[model samples]
Target: MARWGWASFLLRRLTGTFVVVVLLSVGVFGLLYLAPGSIQQTLLGTRPATPETIAAIQARYHLNDPVAVQYLRWLGGAVSGDLGVSIRTGMPVSGMLGGRLSLTLALTGYGTLLAALVGIPLGIVGALRQGRTADRLVVTAGVVGLSAPPFAAGLLLLVVFTGDLGWFPGYGAGEGFADTLWHLTLPAVALAAGAVGLLIRFTRAALVRELDQDYVVFARARGLGAPLVLWYAMRNSLVPILTATGLIVTGMLVGTVLVEVTFALPGLGSLLVDSVTFKDVPVVQALALLLTLLIAAVNLLVDLGYSAVDPRVRLGGRTS
Candidate 1:
């Protein structure tokens, strides 16, 4: 593959990503616009929706404009890094998102790391032991993990660790790195449970296929130890695992909504929920766009990782 080819491939992907973000923004904006109930109603609370109050509110937020015009204005502002102020709090959307985004990112990042660390080894062990009792146990555990909801898992953990054992705090993002880690431990585990199950299944399946390949059999026949042969096979099987990992990370970001709500953590998930409940259009729109961009960026990195891990996987159209 030529350098120009690789460049073209990356350029194409970047263009596609931009298109996806645009479409996502349009969809989010449309959905919020079409949702029932007027912003005036949300602002008035229990008060009567008088004609004067409705007109005043509509003019104040430019809600009297056509939906398309409003969307275009918001999109233009987003491009310029001005996401507007929250209707509910009068705070800048960007400023409100900053601290919450950091907390959500931290929770998801640690959860992804923990999932990979625990899942890969479990997968290897299950693959090596095929049909044994250990493999059966792992399979069962994976099934349960996949079937259980994150919030339910979180509640169970809270009951066990915080309720019964009194081991870890049940809520709040604690101060400092160490304290935060302590506080996040249960939430991370709950958030990661489903992802760990998915990784274990994907890794086990990939390894099993790799181990049956000619190269793996040849290496084993040459008197290489089981560990060495498995290592070689694992390298070849990484593409699928990497794909699964990217998806898991994306899911973690989405799943943080439920996990954060369950744990009562001060993260973007909680903020998003509150924003929606209060009909804070600016805050909701900003968070939705940010999450979409984050997912797209992760997927872009995963595509680049393919070429890095396997020389045969040319980012260009032609493979060597």
Candidate 2:
């Protein structure tokens, strides 16, 4: 891989990421502006409010400003690391979000890890076995996993493990490291269910494709042992499998939101849902921007990883 090629690829990805973030910020602010609700009423929560009180609240948050002006104000504050206070709790949005960041990362990381552990081997076996009964079973399980949504999976896990079997707690992020891992077990599994299926299918398909390539044909014809030939196939299949992995990991953000809500975890996903329901625009916008950044960062990493995995992208002077 050439140094100049890597520089150009990185520069392009950074440019794209910046554009996406800018668009997301504008879209988020605009949608909230058009969102039907009274922030004053939401803040007061059924309390009686005089005309004077309402006017004061509006002025305090500069709600009277033009929508574009308001967006610019918010954007400025966001750039300075002050995302403003939550309308619902009057707490700094950054601080509030920071407290819950670990659990969200943990959920996402654990889910991805679990998906890789379960999916990769099954996918390889399926590809190797091809049309056998084992392959059929693996394919069938993948289909079923893909068909089930995270929320439904969470509920079912809760009922069987937490409700009936009493194997795990139903909700709450546990206190310490061990407890938290235990608590997050079900949520992670629920979040990863669909990803597992996706990985299984993607990995199987990638391996199958690699195994049929000319390289594999030559390797076998050269009298390479079965293990050595399969190793060649596995090594070549990494790029596609990595592509699937990147997608699964990013897609887990959405799944994390659903699973968090279903499991009642105090993470960004539940916070987002609650904030939106209560018309907490600051929290919602902050979360939206943060999530967008996270996704963009993951995509950038995946792009870099592709070059590393198969230096052809860099050496060939092509950005894929």
TM per candidate comes to 0.92, 0.92
Per-candidate clash tally:
0, 0
Q: What C-alpha lDDT does candidate 1 achieve relative to the native structure?
A: 0.86
Candidate lDDT (C-alpha), each? 0.86, 0.86
Superposed Cα deviation of residue 1, candidate 1 (Å) = 4.0
Q: After superposition, how far is residue 62 of candidate 1 from its true place, in Å?
A: 3.6
Taking the tens digit of each residue's C-alpha lDDT, what string does model 2 give over 1-320? 37877787778878988998898889877656566666677545455788998987788778888877888998899888899888788899999889987889899999999999999999999999999999999999899889989899999999999999999999999999999999999999997889889989989999999988998889889899999998878877888888988898888887788789998999999999999888787788899888888888898888888777787765444544
